[model samples]
Target: MSLSLRPARRDDAALILAFVRELADYEKLRHEVEAELADIERDLFGSNPRVFCDIAEWDGAPAGFALWFYNYSTFRGRHGIFLEDIFVRPAFRSRGIATALMRALAQRCVTEKLGRFEWNVLDWNAPAIRFYRSVGAIPLDAWTTQRVDGEALERLAAG
Candidate 1:
């Protein structure tokens, strides 16, 4: 199967949203999909866009995508790329699509001299964990990921 990767465009909002919902469904958190295409379109294509994405095509059809953003690394004293999401459709799994998508990001890091590439994986997702390890990523077991959301986040911001 022929596969191609390219930067996402404003016209891809609907496809991206569909892939995101597929991801949420796979993770059994479909209810958490509160985002709309309008929000994605604005955030991805606005004058001061907050994030960026790349799309993967398998045999000229949308097969997967990777959304990412740049972040500052105080320790490295340089910026890094944080992969927010990477998903390959079930029919396209094990066909090297995910690897190609990640390589696109890694190549960007090397070409741009980004400090690092970082992302989080669910603890229970063994297949993804194994795939990540095969690609030279080490598990950051020493660090715990944290977040503030919904009401607590709002209250904290107000205080």
Candidate 2:
């Protein structure tokens, strides 16, 4: 099986959305998928896009994707790549696509002298945790992730 990765192009917006939805579904968070095709197109294919994506193709067929963006680190005094999402279809598992995607992004970080490469995995996802551990990722167990969105975000903004 020939597996290759390419930078996502404008025409791949729909495929990217599909991957997002599939990933959300697999995570049992499909209800959290608020992004539509237009959103994907505008954000990922718009003028001066900030976020970026990479597509993994196996034998010329789409198999998975990795979405990421640059984030600043005040301590490191440099930028890092924050991987927002990485998913490989169930059919594509055990093929090293996920690892390859991570490796590719890590390589980019190294090449660009990025301070770090980071991503979050659900605590309950044993398989994902194991995979990440295998990749030399250590959990910041003392650091808790915080978020505010929807009504909470609106309230905070209104304040």
Per lDDT, the best of the predicted structures is: 2
Evaluate all candidate structures by whole-model CA lDDT and list the values in order: 0.93, 0.95
| Candidate 1 segments exceeding 4 Å error | none
| Candidate 2 accuracy as TM-score | 0.98
lDDT of 1 by residue, 1-159 (tens): 799999999999999999999998887889989999999999998888979999999889999999999998999988999999999999999999999989999999999999999999988889989999888999888999989999999999999
- The per-residue C-alpha lDDT of model 2 at residue 28 equals 100
Residue 43 lDDT in model 1? 95
**Clashes (N, CA, C under 3 Å) per candidate:** 0, 0
CA lDDT, candidate 1, residue 17: 99
Error of 2 at 157 (Å): 1.2
TM-score against truth, every candidate = 0.97, 0.98
